[model samples]
Target: MAALIMVDEPSVQGGRRVSVFRRGREEHLGTAFSDHDVIVFLQAAGLSDPEEVLDDPRWVEWSGGRDWKRPPMR
Candidate 1:
């Protein structure tokens, strides 16, 4: 089975950073400033090709909105 990557909603107070976690795990892998950063985090975590992982639904699961660049203020 493919690894499940969970990306939380962006936090405005945190400089619009989003928390990244592996599904079913409590601890987050890291935080990212944008979608591209997500890929870098995943790579640093020893995952497969970052771009491919980000583009694959089987690997990534996003919360709130996918627009990490300018997430809607909540």
Candidate 2:
């Protein structure tokens, strides 16, 4: 099973986003891309910061929001 991801549009905002997933294909990666590493690019390229986002009190304060849980194992 793939680890739960914490970011969205991992590659759409970044260029050439890639990852070596432990899980195979056909799993809901929690976003449109394969991994959350794209956030690194977005943060580095001045688009977005994953750390800053995680620091947001709204997201952290909220408890009922969508969580990034591992996909159901086969």
| lDDT scores in order | 0.65, 0.34
Residue pairs with clashing backbones, model 2: none
lDDT of 1 by residue, 13-74 (tens): 43333334555564566777766777777777787787876757677767666665464568
Q: Measured by TM-score, how close is model 1 to the native structure?
A: 0.66
**Candidate whose lDDT is highest:** 1
Clashes of each: 0, 0
Clashing pairs in 1: none
Best by TM-score: 1
Model 2 agreement with the true structure over 1-74: per-residue lDDT tens digits? 23323243223333222222224542222222222544553344343445554435442222223233344445
RMSD of 1: 3.9
Candidate RMSDs in order: 3.9, 13.3
